[model samples]
Target: MTKQPAHIVVAGGGYVGLYTAHRLQRRLRRELGRGTVRITVISPEPYMTYQPFLPEAAAGSISPRHVVVPLRRVLAKCRFVPGAVTAVDTEGHTVSVRTVAGEEAGGEPLRIAYDELVLAPGSISRTLPVPGLAEHGIGFKTVEEAIGLRNHVLEQLDIASSTRDSAVRSAALTFVFVGGGYAGVEALAELEDMGRYACRYYHNIRPEEQKWMLVEATDRILPEVGEEMGRYAQRELRGRNIDIRLGTRLESCEDRTAVLSDGSRHPARTLVWTAGVKPHPVLAACGVPLDDRGRVRCTTTLRVEGVDHVWSAGDAAAVPDLTAPPADPPALCAPNAQHAVRQARRLADNIAAAVRGRPAADYRHRNAGSVASLGLHKGVARIYGRRLKGFPAWLLHRAYHLSRVPTFNRKARVLAEWTLAGLFRREIVSLGSLEHPRAEFELAAGSRRHPEDT
Candidate 1:
């Protein structure tokens, strides 16, 4: 009797999923060729987004298309499924997935069996129950959101330039960003810089007319860069006339009016939410051993605790930080791209070893520090206990991320873009209509149709 091939199914095509599958294809080349093992990657998006570049992409520093890796082209040896995994039945080794279109149409889900399961569904933006947040708040987690924000900001500038009413102009000129983490800080700074540069082209609008606000619930921003650097960032932003409201929260956003916890209210047309993220909710239904925080509990070797033939890592897993100080209680790694990329590589190697009946090694790495871009020629960095800021830090931020971005083709294109941008002025044109390309066509069609045509 012929033996069946072992099937490995990976969930989520983000950093973890893509890197894991790519490593597997490289390590298990012989097994894959012999039809002894197969790998399948499931994700809603066909491309893996390089999230670190999102802020730059939003500010037009990098093209949106260059920041995402096409999964089919990169993972040629693996089966790629463009869908979402709804549930995982560990006992039956089956996973239920809904195709993108099917999920939109409310159709039935499809199930596939697997011999090995990799849980890397990643996390989603963590939101609060603040009033009017659902209707007025915009997130900065995806490329689509970044693009929308760019267009929205430019559209607001256009409105401010053309409007005569004081109230309307004030609202159009006000831009508010909540949360002071990397996403909030970088996004606000880059967009504000773009807006300032764009003002040179406007006849009526001045850069000072734009009110840029940064709200943070914590006492300081950019906690990852240490206190000194964080304070430096604060000074830099304040010099730009950005209102940095520390120890403040967004109480409400009713009717496009932002009410702060400090009893201050402002009429703003834009509100960006980048507070933080929680583990993917799908893990709750995956029948895996999860920690109290809804993160999959994993062994030091990246295997799902108390489960065989299962592995997990990235932001969705509570993997112990072996490199942490001994006195630290519950030393789990932080949910950052730095850890996720490294964890995925280790997880892939360990999985391959388990399949080959070899001993798996535990993952251990010291924190490598952080680098953040404030805007063009502005940044902060803390690497290996050394501190840096300003243009030097900004150059380091770009060079480091440029080296880390996957694929030589993408890196080359990004470099070429930077070269061209240096020779030309920044493009500040707003293409808001791209969001609803068919609006005009539909409106014209409706007007041309007779009422009795139906």
Candidate 2:
């Protein structure tokens, strides 16, 4: 009797899901062609976003279209399912998926059976119960959000330029970003730089008039780059007139006012939330063992702890750090792209080994270090015990991320854009109408009575 083909279902299309499937296609080319192995990737968005370029995308340094890789094009051999995995039945070896059409039509979820499961649903923004936050705050995790933020910031400038009311103008010019991590600092810095440069076009708005604030609960920023380097970053931002409020938390944002833990309040129209992220909710309902932090518990070999025929990695899994020293408190690998990309390769290798009845190898690597960009020509780096700052650091930051952006097409496009950007003035055009494309047409067609009538 001929053995049935093994079906592998990979959840999420971010770093882990995309890379794992891509590597698997190359590793199992013969098996895939012979109908002995099949791979399926499920994700909400068809493209996998390179999040490191989000700040540049928001700053208009690179076109947003080039910041994401199309999954169907990259993983030609793997079946692509444009849907979200709502739940996973590990014991039954099936996953319930809610496709985009099913969601719009309010239909039942589709169930898919798999011989092996790769849980890489990634993460969602870790939000708190802060009042008015849900209604007022913006997240910076997706390409849509990044581009939306860029348009919003420019729109605020337009508002500030035309508003007669002092209070309204003040609020419109004020921008507050919470969290001091890479997403927060880089985003705020890049936008701040762009905002400052764009002020030249506005006759009434001055760069100094725009209030850009960074609020963090911790006492330091850029903790990934070490304390000394973090301090250098803090000093660099502070020198740029950025209000760096360390050891402060956002208590509330009701009535367009940001109340902080330090008993300070700022009236701002923009409040960006990038505090942190937690594993996807599907992990909780996946019937798999999870660590205290809700990440899937996994062995060093990337196999799900105590669960056969299941594996996990990336932000969704708590992978042990074999390179860390033996101590009372164990160290888990940090959930960054550096580790996620590396872990995905290792995870793919282990899966291939399991298929061939070979022994799986443990995932291990010493962190190379951290590099962060604080806007153009300004950055901080701590690599191999050597510290760099300013222009050199900025150049290194670009070179490092450029080498890892995935796909030769993207790398070439990004490099060409950068070359053009250096020779030409930055584009400050605001395309806010993209958010509501039908608004003007609705008014002309008498579909709506007023502009505000959505």
What TM-score would every model get versus the actual structure?
0.97, 0.97
> Can you give the lDDT of residue 73 in candidate 2?
93
User: Which regions of candidate 1 fall more than 4 Å away from where they truly are?
Assistant: 101-107, 327-329, 450-454
Model 1: which residue pairs collide?
none
How far in Å is the alpha carbon of 130 misplaced in model 1?
Answer: 0.8
Tens digits of per-residue lDDT, candidate 1, 1-454, equal: 9998989899999999999999999999999999999999999999999988898888898999998999999899999999999999988999999897787788789898999899999999999998999999999988999999999999999999988999999999999999999999999999999999999999899999999999999999999999999999999999999999999999999899999999999999999999999999999999998888899999999999988788999999999988777754558989999999999999999888877889999999878799999999999999999999999999999999999888898899999988887789999999899999999999998789676987
lDDT of 2 by residue, 1-454 (tens): 9898989889899999999999999888899999999999999999999999999999999999999999999999999999999998878999999998898999899899998889999999999999989999999999999999999999999999998999999999999999999999999999999999999999999999999999999999999999998999999999889999999999999988999999999999999999999999888888899988999999999999988899999999999898988866578999999999999999988888888779999999878888999999999999988999999999999999999987898899999999999999999999989989999988888854665775
Compared with the true structure, model 1 gives a TM-score of: 0.97
Which pairs of residues have clashing backbones in candidate 2?
none
Query: What is the lDDT, from 0 to 100, of the residue 419 in candidate 1?
Result: 84
- Model 2: CA > 4 A from native: 447-454
